[model samples]
Target: MVLIGYWLIEKLFTFEAYKTRNNRGFIIRQITHHKTKQEKERQREKLINMEKRVLYGLVVMLMYLVGGGYSQGVVEWIRDKAEWEEILVKTEIHIGVMVTSPLCGAPCDIVNDQVARFVETYGDRIKFYKINVLETLFFALDYKILTVPTVIIFKEGTINLRFESLSDWGMFYELLVNSSILDFPPDLSPAPAPAPSDSDPDADLPPPLQSGE
Candidate 1:
Protein backbone atom coordinates (compact mmCIF):
# COMPACT_ATOMS: atom_id res chain seq x y z
CA MET A 1 0.00 0.00 0.00
CA VAL A 2 1.06 3.64 -0.56
CA LEU A 3 1.06 4.31 3.19
CA ILE A 4 3.28 1.30 3.91
CA GLY A 5 5.81 2.42 1.27
CA TYR A 6 5.79 6.01 2.52
CA TRP A 7 6.36 4.84 6.10
CA LEU A 8 9.21 2.61 4.93
CA ILE A 9 10.88 5.49 3.08
CA GLU A 10 10.60 7.74 6.15
CA LYS A 11 12.13 5.03 8.37
CA LEU A 12 15.01 4.63 5.93
CA PHE A 13 15.69 8.41 5.58
CA THR A 14 15.04 10.76 8.51
CA PHE A 15 15.58 14.50 9.26
CA GLU A 16 18.75 13.72 11.25
CA ALA A 17 20.43 11.97 8.27
CA TYR A 18 19.31 14.77 5.87
CA LYS A 19 21.06 17.36 8.03
CA THR A 20 24.38 15.44 8.16
CA ARG A 21 25.35 14.36 4.59
CA ASN A 22 24.90 14.14 0.82
CA ASN A 23 22.70 11.43 -0.78
CA ARG A 24 25.72 9.09 -1.32
CA GLY A 25 26.92 9.39 2.25
CA PHE A 26 23.35 8.90 3.58
CA ILE A 27 22.91 5.71 1.50
CA ILE A 28 26.31 4.36 2.65
CA ARG A 29 25.53 5.15 6.30
CA GLN A 30 22.07 3.53 6.13
CA ILE A 31 23.55 0.36 4.59
CA THR A 32 26.47 0.19 7.10
CA HIS A 33 24.42 0.39 10.28
CA HIS A 34 20.88 -0.86 9.80
CA LYS A 35 18.71 0.04 12.84
CA THR A 36 17.56 -2.63 15.31
CA LYS A 37 13.94 -3.85 15.07
CA GLN A 38 12.88 -1.92 18.20
CA GLU A 39 14.67 1.28 17.13
CA LYS A 40 13.10 1.22 13.65
CA GLU A 41 9.64 0.68 15.14
CA ARG A 42 10.09 3.56 17.62
CA GLN A 43 11.22 5.97 14.86
CA ARG A 44 8.21 5.05 12.67
CA GLU A 45 5.81 5.75 15.56
CA LYS A 46 7.43 9.11 16.28
CA LEU A 47 7.18 10.24 12.62
CA ILE A 48 3.52 9.19 12.40
CA ASN A 49 2.69 11.08 15.64
CA MET A 50 4.39 14.25 14.35
CA GLU A 51 2.51 14.00 11.04
CA LYS A 52 -0.83 13.62 12.87
CA ARG A 53 -0.21 16.73 14.99
CA VAL A 54 0.66 18.82 11.91
CA LEU A 55 -2.42 17.62 10.02
CA TYR A 56 -4.67 18.37 13.00
CA GLY A 57 -3.26 21.90 13.33
CA LEU A 58 -3.82 22.61 9.63
CA VAL A 59 -7.44 21.37 9.78
CA VAL A 60 -8.24 23.55 12.85
CA MET A 61 -6.78 26.66 11.19
CA LEU A 62 -8.74 26.08 7.99
CA MET A 63 -12.01 25.71 9.90
CA TYR A 64 -11.42 28.90 11.87
CA LEU A 65 -10.65 30.93 8.73
CA VAL A 66 -13.79 29.70 6.99
CA GLY A 67 -16.06 30.27 9.99
CA GLY A 68 -14.80 33.68 11.09
CA GLY A 69 -13.80 35.33 7.79
CA TYR A 70 -16.59 33.98 5.58
CA SER A 71 -19.67 32.84 7.52
CA GLN A 72 -19.73 35.16 10.53
CA GLY A 73 -18.56 38.15 8.51
CA VAL A 74 -21.45 37.83 6.06
CA VAL A 75 -24.01 37.33 8.83
CA GLU A 76 -22.94 40.47 10.72
CA TRP A 77 -22.95 42.59 7.57
CA ILE A 78 -26.51 41.55 6.76
CA ARG A 79 -27.74 42.17 10.29
CA ASP A 80 -26.29 45.69 10.44
CA LYS A 81 -27.64 46.62 7.02
CA ALA A 82 -31.10 45.39 7.96
CA GLU A 83 -31.10 47.38 11.21
CA TRP A 84 -30.22 50.63 9.43
CA GLU A 85 -32.87 50.02 6.79
CA GLU A 86 -35.45 49.50 9.52
CA ILE A 87 -34.50 52.76 11.17
CA LEU A 88 -35.12 54.61 7.90
CA VAL A 89 -38.55 53.01 7.44
CA LYS A 90 -39.89 53.40 10.97
CA THR A 91 -42.17 56.35 11.72
CA GLU A 92 -40.69 57.80 14.87
CA ILE A 93 -38.66 60.74 16.07
CA HIS A 94 -35.06 59.72 15.36
CA ILE A 95 -31.86 61.76 15.59
CA GLY A 96 -28.82 60.64 13.61
CA VAL A 97 -25.41 62.22 14.14
CA MET A 98 -23.05 61.61 11.26
CA VAL A 99 -19.31 61.79 11.90
CA THR A 100 -16.24 60.70 9.97
CA SER A 101 -14.59 59.34 13.12
CA PRO A 102 -15.52 59.30 16.77
CA LEU A 103 -12.12 60.53 18.00
CA CYS A 104 -11.11 62.80 15.15
CA GLY A 105 -11.48 66.30 16.67
CA ALA A 106 -13.06 68.56 19.24
CA PRO A 107 -16.03 69.21 16.96
CA CYS A 108 -16.94 65.54 16.81
CA ASP A 109 -16.49 65.19 20.55
CA ILE A 110 -18.71 68.19 21.25
CA VAL A 111 -21.46 66.90 18.94
CA ASN A 112 -21.36 63.47 20.53
CA ASP A 113 -21.46 64.91 24.03
CA GLN A 114 -24.44 67.14 23.21
CA VAL A 115 -26.34 64.28 21.58
CA ALA A 116 -25.62 62.04 24.56
CA ARG A 117 -26.98 64.62 26.96
CA PHE A 118 -30.03 65.20 24.77
CA VAL A 119 -30.67 61.47 24.59
CA GLU A 120 -30.38 61.09 28.34
CA THR A 121 -32.77 64.00 28.90
CA TYR A 122 -35.40 62.95 26.33
CA GLY A 123 -34.67 59.29 25.77
CA ASP A 124 -38.24 58.28 26.50
CA ARG A 125 -39.52 60.61 23.74
CA ILE A 126 -36.93 60.23 20.94
CA LYS A 127 -34.40 57.76 19.60
CA PHE A 128 -30.79 58.74 18.96
CA TYR A 129 -28.35 56.95 16.64
CA LYS A 130 -24.72 57.74 15.84
CA ILE A 131 -23.61 56.93 12.29
CA ASN A 132 -19.96 56.86 11.28
CA VAL A 133 -19.72 58.27 7.76
CA LEU A 134 -16.68 56.21 6.89
CA GLU A 135 -17.89 52.89 8.27
CA THR A 136 -21.47 53.17 7.06
CA LEU A 137 -21.01 54.71 3.65
CA PHE A 138 -24.22 53.25 2.29
CA PHE A 139 -26.30 54.80 5.05
CA ALA A 140 -24.52 58.10 4.63
CA LEU A 141 -25.19 58.05 0.90
CA ASP A 142 -28.83 57.12 1.42
CA TYR A 143 -29.26 60.03 3.82
CA LYS A 144 -27.22 62.32 1.52
CA ILE A 145 -24.82 63.26 4.30
CA LEU A 146 -22.22 65.66 2.85
CA THR A 147 -20.25 66.69 5.90
CA VAL A 148 -18.88 65.42 9.16
CA PRO A 149 -20.45 66.38 12.49
CA THR A 150 -23.88 66.66 10.89
CA VAL A 151 -26.99 66.23 12.97
CA ILE A 152 -30.27 65.24 11.34
CA ILE A 153 -33.54 64.93 13.20
CA PHE A 154 -36.51 63.05 11.82
CA LYS A 155 -40.13 63.35 12.85
CA GLU A 156 -42.68 60.82 11.54
CA GLY A 157 -40.06 59.54 9.10
CA THR A 158 -39.47 63.04 7.71
CA ILE A 159 -36.42 65.21 8.19
CA ASN A 160 -37.37 68.00 10.55
CA LEU A 161 -34.00 69.63 11.04
CA ARG A 162 -30.46 69.23 9.73
CA PHE A 163 -27.41 71.03 11.11
CA GLU A 164 -23.81 70.95 9.94
CA SER A 165 -20.46 72.05 11.42
CA LEU A 166 -19.48 72.55 15.04
CA SER A 167 -22.06 74.15 17.32
CA ASP A 168 -22.44 74.82 21.01
CA TRP A 169 -24.84 72.83 23.22
CA GLY A 170 -27.02 75.90 23.61
CA MET A 171 -27.48 76.17 19.84
CA PHE A 172 -28.54 72.52 19.62
CA TYR A 173 -30.87 72.90 22.54
CA GLU A 174 -32.44 75.97 20.99
CA LEU A 175 -32.88 74.20 17.65
CA LEU A 176 -34.57 71.21 19.27
CA VAL A 177 -36.83 73.56 21.22
CA ASN A 178 -37.71 75.48 18.04
CA SER A 179 -38.56 72.20 16.31
CA SER A 180 -40.97 71.48 19.19
CA ILE A 181 -39.31 68.09 19.70
CA LEU A 182 -38.51 69.00 23.27
CA ASP A 183 -41.52 69.75 25.46
CA PHE A 184 -39.71 72.25 27.65
CA PRO A 185 -37.07 74.80 26.64
CA PRO A 186 -33.51 74.22 27.79
CA ASP A 187 -32.17 76.86 30.21
CA LEU A 188 -29.76 78.83 27.96
CA SER A 189 -29.31 81.70 30.41
CA PRO A 190 -25.68 82.72 31.00
CA ALA A 191 -24.26 81.82 34.42
CA PRO A 192 -24.32 84.69 36.91
CA ALA A 193 -20.97 86.40 37.65
CA PRO A 194 -19.61 86.04 41.21
CA ALA A 195 -19.96 89.12 43.51
CA PRO A 196 -16.77 91.17 44.06
CA SER A 197 -14.80 89.87 47.07
CA ASP A 198 -13.46 92.07 49.85
CA SER A 199 -10.21 90.01 50.03
CA ASP A 200 -8.09 92.40 47.84
CA PRO A 201 -4.93 93.44 49.79
CA ASP A 202 -4.66 96.82 47.93
CA ALA A 203 -8.15 97.96 48.86
CA ASP A 204 -8.40 101.29 50.74
CA LEU A 205 -8.94 100.40 54.40
CA PRO A 206 -11.35 102.49 56.40
CA PRO A 207 -9.44 105.39 57.96
CA PRO A 208 -8.70 104.36 61.53
CA LEU A 209 -10.83 106.54 63.77
CA GLN A 210 -8.34 108.99 65.21
CA SER A 211 -8.14 107.34 68.63
CA GLY A 212 -11.91 107.98 69.19
CA GLU A 213 -15.16 106.69 67.71
Candidate 2:
Protein backbone atom coordinates (compact mmCIF):
# COMPACT_ATOMS: atom_id res chain seq x y z
CA MET A 1 0.00 0.00 0.00
CA VAL A 2 2.82 2.41 0.80
CA LEU A 3 6.13 1.34 -0.77
CA ILE A 4 8.70 4.16 -1.21
CA GLY A 5 10.71 4.14 -4.42
CA TYR A 6 14.47 3.35 -4.05
CA TRP A 7 15.33 6.15 -6.49
CA LEU A 8 13.50 8.79 -4.36
CA ILE A 9 15.14 7.48 -1.14
CA GLU A 10 18.57 7.65 -2.81
CA LYS A 11 17.87 11.24 -3.91
CA LEU A 12 17.00 12.33 -0.30
CA PHE A 13 20.03 10.54 1.18
CA THR A 14 22.40 12.24 -1.29
CA PHE A 15 20.90 15.73 -0.74
CA GLU A 16 20.62 15.75 3.10
CA ALA A 17 22.51 12.97 4.93
CA TYR A 18 25.44 12.53 2.54
CA LYS A 19 26.01 16.28 2.12
CA THR A 20 25.81 16.96 5.90
CA ARG A 21 28.21 14.09 6.69
CA ASN A 22 30.67 15.35 4.02
CA ASN A 23 30.73 18.87 5.59
CA ARG A 24 30.94 17.75 9.25
CA GLY A 25 34.79 17.71 9.40
CA PHE A 26 35.07 21.19 7.83
CA ILE A 27 32.49 22.57 10.27
CA ILE A 28 34.33 21.03 13.25
CA ARG A 29 37.65 22.53 12.06
CA GLN A 30 36.06 25.97 11.65
CA ILE A 31 34.62 25.83 15.14
CA THR A 32 37.99 24.83 16.61
CA HIS A 33 39.71 27.68 14.71
CA HIS A 34 37.19 30.22 16.01
CA LYS A 35 37.69 28.99 19.60
CA THR A 36 41.45 29.35 19.31
CA LYS A 37 41.05 32.84 17.86
CA GLN A 38 38.82 33.86 20.76
CA GLU A 39 41.37 32.57 23.30
CA LYS A 40 44.15 34.53 21.60
CA GLU A 41 42.02 37.66 21.56
CA ARG A 42 41.40 37.36 25.33
CA GLN A 43 45.12 36.97 26.01
CA ARG A 44 45.90 39.98 23.84
CA GLU A 45 43.40 42.13 25.76
CA LYS A 46 44.94 41.12 29.09
CA LEU A 47 48.38 42.05 27.85
CA ILE A 48 47.12 45.41 26.63
CA ASN A 49 45.53 46.14 30.01
CA MET A 50 48.80 45.36 31.80
CA GLU A 51 50.73 47.66 29.47
CA LYS A 52 48.19 50.43 29.99
CA ARG A 53 48.66 50.22 33.74
CA VAL A 54 52.41 50.59 33.40
CA LEU A 55 52.00 53.49 31.02
CA TYR A 56 49.61 55.22 33.40
CA GLY A 57 52.10 54.89 36.26
CA LEU A 58 54.82 56.40 34.10
CA VAL A 59 52.58 59.29 33.13
CA VAL A 60 51.82 59.98 36.78
CA MET A 61 55.52 60.01 37.66
CA LEU A 62 56.23 62.38 34.79
CA MET A 63 53.46 64.68 35.94
CA TYR A 64 54.78 64.69 39.48
CA LEU A 65 58.24 65.58 38.21
CA VAL A 66 56.65 68.52 36.43
CA GLY A 67 54.91 69.67 39.64
CA GLY A 68 51.53 68.10 39.05
CA GLY A 69 50.12 67.10 42.46
CA TYR A 70 52.00 69.62 44.61
CA SER A 71 53.98 72.76 44.04
CA GLN A 72 57.75 72.40 44.00
CA GLY A 73 60.41 74.56 45.73
CA VAL A 74 58.42 74.81 48.99
CA VAL A 75 60.58 72.49 51.07
CA GLU A 76 64.15 73.81 51.17
CA TRP A 77 67.20 71.72 51.95
CA ILE A 78 69.27 72.86 54.94
CA ARG A 79 73.02 72.43 54.65
CA ASP A 80 74.67 75.43 56.29
CA LYS A 81 74.85 77.45 59.52
CA ALA A 82 73.10 80.42 57.89
CA GLU A 83 70.14 78.27 56.87
CA TRP A 84 70.01 76.68 60.34
CA GLU A 85 69.97 80.12 61.92
CA GLU A 86 67.06 81.17 59.72
CA ILE A 87 65.00 78.13 60.71
CA LEU A 88 65.94 78.45 64.37
CA VAL A 89 64.90 82.08 64.58
CA LYS A 90 61.68 81.66 62.62
CA THR A 91 58.42 82.00 64.56
CA GLU A 92 57.22 78.58 63.46
CA ILE A 93 59.33 76.09 61.53
CA HIS A 94 59.51 72.34 60.87
CA ILE A 95 62.90 70.69 60.41
CA GLY A 96 62.96 67.22 58.90
CA VAL A 97 66.00 64.93 59.01
CA MET A 98 66.05 62.72 55.93
CA VAL A 99 68.53 60.36 54.27
CA THR A 100 69.38 61.18 50.68
CA SER A 101 71.99 58.53 50.14
CA PRO A 102 71.66 56.13 47.23
CA LEU A 103 71.39 53.30 49.73
CA CYS A 104 68.28 54.79 51.33
CA GLY A 105 65.48 52.24 50.97
CA ALA A 106 61.70 52.44 50.82
CA PRO A 107 60.98 53.28 54.46
CA CYS A 108 63.41 56.16 54.59
CA ASP A 109 62.27 57.57 51.26
CA ILE A 110 58.58 57.16 52.17
CA VAL A 111 58.96 59.16 55.38
CA ASN A 112 60.94 61.81 53.59
CA ASP A 113 58.25 62.10 50.89
CA GLN A 114 55.48 62.35 53.50
CA VAL A 115 57.04 65.42 55.05
CA ALA A 116 57.93 66.88 51.69
CA ARG A 117 54.37 66.46 50.41
CA PHE A 118 52.84 67.96 53.55
CA VAL A 119 54.94 71.08 53.22
CA GLU A 120 53.25 71.96 49.93
CA THR A 121 50.33 73.64 51.73
CA TYR A 122 51.85 74.35 55.15
CA GLY A 123 55.03 75.94 53.86
CA ASP A 124 53.26 79.24 53.25
CA ARG A 125 52.40 79.69 56.94
CA ILE A 126 55.35 77.88 58.53
CA LYS A 127 58.85 77.43 57.14
CA PHE A 128 60.00 73.89 56.30
CA TYR A 129 63.56 72.59 55.89
CA LYS A 130 64.94 69.16 55.05
CA ILE A 131 68.33 68.04 56.30
CA ASN A 132 70.03 65.27 54.38
CA VAL A 133 71.88 63.15 56.92
CA LEU A 134 74.26 61.82 54.29
CA GLU A 135 75.28 65.30 53.22
CA THR A 136 75.41 66.83 56.71
CA LEU A 137 75.94 64.21 59.40
CA PHE A 138 76.94 66.85 61.93
CA PHE A 139 73.48 68.39 61.91
CA ALA A 140 71.91 65.04 62.65
CA LEU A 141 74.24 64.43 65.59
CA ASP A 142 73.75 67.98 66.90
CA TYR A 143 69.95 67.64 66.81
CA LYS A 144 70.12 64.08 68.27
CA ILE A 145 68.50 62.86 65.08
CA LEU A 146 69.36 59.20 65.52
CA THR A 147 66.49 58.23 63.24
CA VAL A 148 66.93 58.60 59.49
CA PRO A 149 63.58 60.34 59.13
CA THR A 150 62.80 62.47 62.18
CA VAL A 151 60.64 65.60 62.22
CA ILE A 152 61.34 68.31 64.78
CA ILE A 153 58.78 71.06 65.17
CA PHE A 154 59.79 74.47 66.47
CA LYS A 155 57.30 77.10 67.56
CA GLU A 156 58.16 80.49 69.08
CA GLY A 157 61.86 79.82 68.38
CA THR A 158 62.00 76.69 70.55
CA ILE A 159 61.72 72.94 70.01
CA ASN A 160 58.04 72.05 70.39
CA LEU A 161 57.71 68.45 69.26
CA ARG A 162 60.17 65.75 68.21
CA PHE A 163 58.78 62.91 66.09
CA GLU A 164 61.36 60.13 65.94
CA SER A 165 61.17 57.91 62.87
CA LEU A 166 57.71 59.34 62.13
CA SER A 167 55.69 56.60 60.45
CA ASP A 168 52.18 57.89 59.73
CA TRP A 169 50.06 61.04 59.67
CA GLY A 170 47.84 59.90 62.56
CA MET A 171 50.40 60.61 65.28
CA PHE A 172 51.51 63.71 63.47
CA TYR A 173 47.91 64.89 63.10
CA GLU A 174 46.99 64.15 66.68
CA LEU A 175 50.08 65.90 68.05
CA LEU A 176 49.65 68.92 65.83
CA VAL A 177 45.95 69.19 66.68
CA ASN A 178 46.60 68.93 70.41
CA SER A 179 49.35 71.52 70.18
CA SER A 180 47.27 73.68 67.83
CA ILE A 181 50.18 73.83 65.44
CA LEU A 182 49.21 72.22 62.11
CA ASP A 183 45.84 71.24 60.68
CA PHE A 184 46.62 68.03 58.77
CA PRO A 185 44.36 65.76 56.75
CA PRO A 186 42.55 63.22 58.93
CA ASP A 187 41.12 60.58 56.55
CA LEU A 188 43.75 60.78 53.83
CA SER A 189 46.50 59.22 55.92
CA PRO A 190 49.14 57.21 54.07
CA ALA A 191 50.88 54.00 55.03
CA PRO A 192 53.29 54.24 57.98
CA ALA A 193 56.98 54.61 57.10
CA PRO A 194 59.06 52.17 59.07
CA ALA A 195 62.80 52.40 59.72
CA PRO A 196 64.78 50.37 57.21
CA SER A 197 67.08 48.05 59.13
CA ASP A 198 69.91 47.02 56.83
CA SER A 199 70.74 50.08 54.71
CA ASP A 200 70.03 53.12 56.89
CA PRO A 201 72.71 55.82 57.14
CA ASP A 202 71.72 56.34 60.78
CA ALA A 203 72.59 52.74 61.63
CA ASP A 204 76.35 53.43 61.28
CA LEU A 205 76.25 55.99 64.10
CA PRO A 206 77.43 54.94 67.56
CA PRO A 207 74.77 53.16 69.60
CA PRO A 208 72.55 55.50 71.66
CA LEU A 209 73.84 56.26 75.15
CA GLN A 210 72.45 54.06 77.90
CA SER A 211 70.24 55.63 80.54
CA GLY A 212 71.63 56.89 83.90
CA GLU A 213 75.01 57.78 82.48
Candidate 3:
Protein backbone atom coordinates (compact mmCIF):
# COMPACT_ATOMS: atom_id res chain seq x y z
CA MET A 1 0.00 0.00 0.00
CA VAL A 2 2.80 2.52 0.71
CA LEU A 3 4.56 1.78 -2.57
CA ILE A 4 1.31 2.27 -4.56
CA GLY A 5 0.71 5.67 -2.92
CA TYR A 6 4.24 6.87 -3.70
CA TRP A 7 3.80 5.75 -7.34
CA LEU A 8 0.51 7.69 -7.67
CA ILE A 9 2.07 10.94 -6.35
CA GLU A 10 5.00 10.63 -8.73
CA LYS A 11 2.63 10.15 -11.71
CA LEU A 12 0.66 13.32 -10.76
CA PHE A 13 3.84 15.39 -10.47
CA THR A 14 5.09 14.19 -13.85
CA PHE A 15 1.79 15.11 -15.56
CA GLU A 16 1.88 18.60 -13.99
CA ALA A 17 5.46 19.17 -15.20
CA TYR A 18 4.50 18.08 -18.74
CA LYS A 19 1.54 20.53 -18.80
CA THR A 20 3.74 23.38 -17.56
CA ARG A 21 6.29 22.75 -20.28
CA ASN A 22 3.59 22.69 -22.97
CA ASN A 23 2.15 25.99 -21.74
CA ARG A 24 5.63 27.57 -21.80
CA GLY A 25 6.15 26.40 -25.38
CA PHE A 26 2.78 27.89 -26.46
CA ILE A 27 3.70 31.27 -24.99
CA ILE A 28 7.04 31.26 -26.74
CA ARG A 29 5.39 30.53 -30.10
CA GLN A 30 2.91 33.40 -29.63
CA ILE A 31 5.72 35.81 -28.83
CA THR A 32 7.68 34.71 -31.88
CA HIS A 33 4.65 35.23 -34.14
CA HIS A 34 4.09 38.75 -32.76
CA LYS A 35 7.73 39.65 -33.27
CA THR A 36 7.65 38.42 -36.89
CA LYS A 37 4.53 40.48 -37.59
CA GLN A 38 6.19 43.60 -36.21
CA GLU A 39 9.24 43.05 -38.39
CA LYS A 40 7.11 42.65 -41.54
CA GLU A 41 5.19 45.83 -40.77
CA ARG A 42 8.41 47.75 -40.35
CA GLN A 43 9.71 46.42 -43.65
CA ARG A 44 6.51 47.43 -45.49
CA GLU A 45 6.70 50.95 -44.07
CA LYS A 46 10.28 51.29 -45.17
CA LEU A 47 9.42 50.20 -48.70
CA ILE A 48 6.62 52.76 -48.94
CA ASN A 49 8.91 55.57 -47.87
CA MET A 50 11.57 54.47 -50.31
CA GLU A 51 9.05 54.46 -53.15
CA LYS A 52 7.89 57.98 -52.32
CA ARG A 53 11.47 59.23 -52.26
CA VAL A 54 12.18 57.67 -55.63
CA LEU A 55 9.05 59.17 -57.14
CA TYR A 56 9.98 62.59 -55.81
CA GLY A 57 13.45 62.29 -57.26
CA LEU A 58 12.08 61.35 -60.67
CA VAL A 59 9.74 64.31 -60.71
CA VAL A 60 12.58 66.68 -59.84
CA MET A 61 14.74 65.28 -62.60
CA LEU A 62 11.97 65.61 -65.16
CA MET A 63 11.51 69.24 -64.25
CA TYR A 64 15.20 69.92 -64.70
CA LEU A 65 15.31 68.24 -68.09
CA VAL A 66 12.30 70.11 -69.41
CA GLY A 67 13.65 73.39 -68.14
CA GLY A 68 17.11 72.84 -69.54
CA GLY A 69 16.00 71.69 -72.97
CA TYR A 70 14.17 74.87 -73.93
CA SER A 71 16.03 77.31 -76.18
CA GLN A 72 17.71 80.27 -74.51
CA GLY A 73 15.40 82.69 -76.29
CA VAL A 74 12.31 80.92 -75.05
CA VAL A 75 13.69 80.78 -71.55
CA GLU A 76 14.72 84.41 -71.56
CA TRP A 77 11.41 85.45 -73.02
CA ILE A 78 9.54 83.60 -70.28
CA ARG A 79 11.68 85.20 -67.59
CA ASP A 80 11.30 88.68 -69.01
CA LYS A 81 7.52 88.45 -69.26
CA ALA A 82 7.22 87.00 -65.79
CA GLU A 83 9.51 89.45 -64.04
CA TRP A 84 9.13 92.69 -65.99
CA GLU A 85 5.39 93.12 -65.45
CA GLU A 86 5.84 95.54 -62.55
CA ILE A 87 8.21 97.74 -64.54
CA LEU A 88 6.48 97.22 -67.89
CA VAL A 89 5.04 100.33 -69.43
CA LYS A 90 1.84 99.67 -67.45
CA THR A 91 -0.33 99.07 -70.49
CA GLU A 92 -3.91 98.82 -69.40
CA ILE A 93 -5.28 96.20 -71.70
CA HIS A 94 -8.97 95.97 -72.43
CA ILE A 95 -8.38 92.32 -71.53
CA GLY A 96 -6.88 90.97 -68.33
CA VAL A 97 -7.34 87.42 -67.07
CA MET A 98 -6.21 85.25 -64.18
CA VAL A 99 -5.01 81.76 -64.98
CA THR A 100 -5.27 79.27 -62.12
CA SER A 101 -2.59 76.74 -62.90
CA PRO A 102 0.89 76.21 -64.33
CA LEU A 103 0.54 72.47 -64.53
CA CYS A 104 0.71 70.41 -67.72
CA GLY A 105 -2.59 68.99 -68.94
CA ALA A 106 -4.67 68.80 -72.09
CA PRO A 107 -6.56 72.08 -72.18
CA CYS A 108 -4.41 73.69 -69.55
CA ASP A 109 -1.26 73.25 -71.62
CA ILE A 110 -3.02 74.49 -74.73
CA VAL A 111 -4.30 77.61 -73.02
CA ASN A 112 -1.02 78.35 -71.31
CA ASP A 113 0.96 77.83 -74.48
CA GLN A 114 -1.29 80.19 -76.38
CA VAL A 115 -1.00 82.82 -73.71
CA ALA A 116 2.76 82.47 -73.59
CA ARG A 117 2.90 82.82 -77.33
CA PHE A 118 0.72 85.92 -77.21
CA VAL A 119 2.85 87.39 -74.50
CA GLU A 120 5.97 86.76 -76.51
CA THR A 121 4.55 88.17 -79.75
CA TYR A 122 2.74 91.25 -78.49
CA GLY A 123 4.25 91.56 -75.06
CA ASP A 124 5.65 94.94 -76.04
CA ARG A 125 2.14 96.06 -76.95
CA ILE A 126 0.07 94.18 -74.38
CA LYS A 127 0.72 92.56 -71.04
CA PHE A 128 -0.71 89.18 -70.08
CA TYR A 129 -0.16 88.10 -66.50
CA LYS A 130 -0.65 84.60 -65.12
CA ILE A 131 -1.01 83.69 -61.45
CA ASN A 132 -1.20 80.13 -60.18
CA VAL A 133 -4.26 79.09 -58.22
CA LEU A 134 -2.23 77.34 -55.55
CA GLU A 135 0.37 80.08 -55.21
CA THR A 136 -1.77 83.22 -55.51
CA LEU A 137 -4.92 82.40 -53.62
CA PHE A 138 -5.29 85.88 -52.27
CA PHE A 139 -4.91 87.54 -55.65
CA ALA A 140 -7.40 85.14 -57.17
CA LEU A 141 -9.98 85.92 -54.51
CA ASP A 142 -9.34 89.64 -54.74
CA TYR A 143 -10.19 89.39 -58.43
CA LYS A 144 -13.04 86.98 -57.73
CA ILE A 145 -11.42 84.37 -59.95
CA LEU A 146 -12.90 81.05 -58.84
CA THR A 147 -11.95 78.99 -61.89
CA VAL A 148 -8.92 78.25 -63.99
CA PRO A 149 -8.15 79.89 -67.35
CA THR A 150 -10.12 82.96 -66.32
CA VAL A 151 -9.55 85.87 -68.64
CA ILE A 152 -9.77 89.41 -67.31
CA ILE A 153 -9.01 92.53 -69.30
CA PHE A 154 -7.94 95.59 -67.40
CA LYS A 155 -7.87 99.24 -68.44
CA GLU A 156 -6.01 101.72 -66.25
CA GLY A 157 -5.47 98.86 -63.81
CA THR A 158 -9.17 98.12 -63.29
CA ILE A 159 -11.03 95.07 -64.48
CA ASN A 160 -12.88 95.76 -67.74
CA LEU A 161 -13.53 92.42 -69.40
CA ARG A 162 -13.57 88.80 -68.20
CA PHE A 163 -14.19 85.40 -69.70
CA GLU A 164 -13.77 81.82 -68.57
CA SER A 165 -12.54 78.95 -70.73
CA LEU A 166 -10.90 79.32 -74.11
CA SER A 167 -11.94 81.87 -76.73
CA ASP A 168 -10.86 83.31 -80.06
CA TRP A 169 -7.25 84.53 -79.92
CA GLY A 170 -7.91 87.21 -82.55
CA MET A 171 -10.67 88.77 -80.52
CA PHE A 172 -8.47 88.97 -77.47
CA TYR A 173 -5.67 90.59 -79.43
CA GLU A 174 -8.01 93.10 -80.98
CA LEU A 175 -9.38 94.08 -77.60
CA LEU A 176 -5.88 94.57 -76.26
CA VAL A 177 -4.75 96.60 -79.24
CA ASN A 178 -7.71 98.98 -79.04
CA SER A 179 -7.40 99.39 -75.27
CA SER A 180 -5.23 102.47 -75.95
CA ILE A 181 -3.15 101.55 -72.95
CA LEU A 182 -0.49 100.25 -75.29
CA ASP A 183 1.29 103.06 -77.04
CA PHE A 184 0.86 101.85 -80.64
CA PRO A 185 4.47 102.63 -81.63
CA PRO A 186 5.79 102.67 -78.07
CA ASP A 187 6.79 106.25 -77.30
CA LEU A 188 10.51 106.23 -78.11
CA SER A 189 12.24 109.62 -77.99
CA PRO A 190 14.12 110.22 -81.29
CA ALA A 191 17.87 109.80 -80.99
CA PRO A 192 19.75 113.03 -81.70
CA ALA A 193 21.11 113.01 -85.32
CA PRO A 194 24.73 111.90 -85.53
CA ALA A 195 26.91 115.03 -85.18
CA PRO A 196 27.59 116.29 -88.73
CA SER A 197 30.36 113.91 -89.84
CA ASP A 198 33.74 115.60 -89.21
CA SER A 199 35.06 113.85 -92.39
CA ASP A 200 32.47 115.59 -94.58
CA PRO A 201 34.20 116.62 -97.79
CA ASP A 202 31.21 118.70 -98.82
CA ALA A 203 31.51 121.18 -95.96
CA ASP A 204 35.01 122.24 -97.05
CA LEU A 205 34.05 122.82 -100.73
CA PRO A 206 33.95 126.60 -101.53
CA PRO A 207 30.27 127.55 -101.68
CA PRO A 208 29.12 126.10 -105.02
CA LEU A 209 30.23 128.79 -107.68
CA GLN A 210 27.22 131.01 -107.09
CA SER A 211 25.09 129.05 -109.51
CA GLY A 212 26.90 128.10 -112.75
CA GLU A 213 28.21 131.19 -114.66
Top candidate by TM-score: 2
lDDT of the candidates, in the order given: 0.60, 0.61, 0.57
Per-residue error (Å), model 3, residue 126: 3.3
**What are the candidates' C-alpha RMSDs?**
21.1, 22.0, 17.6
Off by over 4 Å in 1: 1-79, 166-170, 183-213
Poorest 10 consecutive residues of model 2 by lDDT? 167-176
Candidate 3, TM-score vs. the true structure? Answer: 0.38
lDDT of candidate model 3 versus the reference = 0.57
Model 1: per-residue lDDT, tens digit, 38-95? 6888999999967755654554455446533122111112125677667768735554
Q: Supply candidate 2's per-residue lDDT for 53.
A: 51
lDDT: which is higher, 1 or 3? Answer: 1
Quick one: best lDDT, which candidate? 2
In model 3, the runs with Cα more than 4 Å from the true position are: 1-97, 102-104, 166-183, 187-213
lDDT per residue as tens, model 3, 57-134 = 554455347644212212122133344345234554433444657552334443444455456556654556555666
lDDT of 2 by residue, 1-213 (tens): 134577787788789987898699789999999999999999999999677556545544554676554435366678876767766776444443343444544444444445556566455545666777777777776777666556677767667677765444324434544554555434667889886688678975799988994
